[model samples]
Target: FALIHSRWTRRVTLLKRALSEIGIDPRRVHLEWISANEGAKFQRTVSWYVNEIKRLGPSPVAEVVDGQA
Candidate 1:
């Protein structure tokens, strides 16, 4: 479990770096660990992330892909 957690942490860090390099907000990425019994926690996490994404507004990468950038 420790090894898996370490690997995921490293992967997430790398992902954030790649996103930043591509001009995307690193805050747009999220990583959470919730057990199967934590349904409420999962719901709350999803809700919070949704609100955060809304607060961040549309991604700049989307505009570039749509040829607007």
Candidate 2:
């Protein structure tokens, strides 16, 4: 996890490299913005990410998939 400001700027490239490095082929990607001062934003962000991961169904990585489920 990362702070929103530093996170968004590198999100795309970071995810790309991350997936590539881990040998995971991502069918899709998502980016979200939430500032440090925004409690509501942080809550929403976590909720959205949780929902998104659920929608994605499951991951090929067993550990990660099990963690989410």
After superposition on all C-alphas, the RMSD of every candidate to the true structure, in Å, is 0.9, 6.1
lDDT of each: 0.95, 0.70
TM-score for every candidate vs. truth?
Answer: 0.92, 0.51
Which candidate ranks first by lDDT, i.e. highest?
1
Clash-forming residue pairs, model 1: none
Alpha-carbon deviation at 55 in model 1, angstroms: 0.5
Off by over 4 Å in 2: 1-8, 17-33, 63-69
lDDT of 2: 0.70
Worst 10 residues of 1 by lDDT: 1-10
Model 1 per-residue lDDT tens digits across residues 1-69: 889988998999999999999889999999998899999999999999999999999999889889998
